[model samples]
Target: MLFAHDTEVSLRAAVALVNSASEPETMRTTADLDAFFAEHGYTGRHTGGADELAEVRRLRPRLRTLLTSDRDTAAELVNDLLRDAGALPRLVRHGDVDWHVHAVDDDAPLAERIAVETAMAMIDVIRSDEMSRLDVCSDETCDGVVLDLSRNRSKRFCSPACGNRNAVAAYRARRR
Candidate 1:
């Protein structure tokens, strides 16, 4: 199913980024590989030094908890991130992007920027009654988060691969 709203896409991206934490090699440390930042469209000049990278890396665990936890826990965590990031809404127009609400500045540290954008998108999700789309995969052994945008609410796996694996497992168990 298609997510027709920008906030939905943002939430999906946030979930994908948070789930990246399940594999330490992908994000590694804050100085995160240039390739990673480039792909995620995370742009801002940084000394790319140790401390800066460390803080950005720190955000991974926080975001992970946001994705995997229950509604109450996720709300509290997002609130904490917004507060700690000093988030205050202001409309911004940058490059080709139209005027959109930015809760933080252009050059705020990478982690703060990510937190603000994600928190704002989550607020949109809550308002739009789409919070149920934020979910962990139903597969028993897989802990990845799944952002389901299906019109029929049928999605249950992080990916088609995980879906196939779980389906096969289910079939085998039934046959036993």
Candidate 2:
């Protein structure tokens, strides 16, 4: 694995959150936020409502910058995030997951928890010199983040849909 299982999960969640803000936004309602939280297996105080949803949505741009920045800049951004959140890392295991780090209290606001977790995971990526694993989507029409976790580091699109679209376009061009 490129990183610990929990670290990879956190990074994937962060990428999904960032991509949700792209054109044709997928997270436009409280229900969307709830689904996101559930899908990511987030265990914490989740006050479901428009205000909470807005707070989470506001994190996208900052996370995108962190994910796409150079290694040094990404480290600086992660440091800033951890400092701003007053993060204190500790090991915690809940549900089916094994022991892993949780850097914020369970009662912390969902946005803060999400941010701090993403920042903490980035710590591993930065330290391991795996910043190349995080990248902007290759689809020129989409401004989404792509996490290349494949063994060969061959992932180049944010989603299968984008990859298929580009492939179809290439095939058509070849036929012409």
The candidate that achieves the highest TM-score relative to the unseen native structure: 2
Candidates' C-alpha lDDT: 0.71, 0.94
In TM-score terms, candidate 1 sits at 0.80
The per-residue C-alpha lDDT of model 2 at residue 99 equals 99
Instruction: Evaluate residue 70 in candidate 1 and report its C-alpha lDDT on the 0 to 100 scale.
Output: 66
Q: Show the colliding residue pairs in model 2.
A: none
**Global CA lDDT computed for model 2:** 0.94
Clash count for each candidate, listed in order shown: 0, 0
In model 1, what are the clashing residue pairs, if there are any? none
TM-score of each: 0.80, 0.98
User: 1-176 in candidate 1: lDDT tens per residue?
Assistant: 34434465567667767766664345665445455556555556555667766766677677777766767776787798889988989976666666677787778876688777788877766556576777888877777788877788888988777899988988999999
Compute the lDDT of residue 28 as modeled in candidate 2. Answer: 99
Cα RMSD, each candidate: 2.9, 0.7
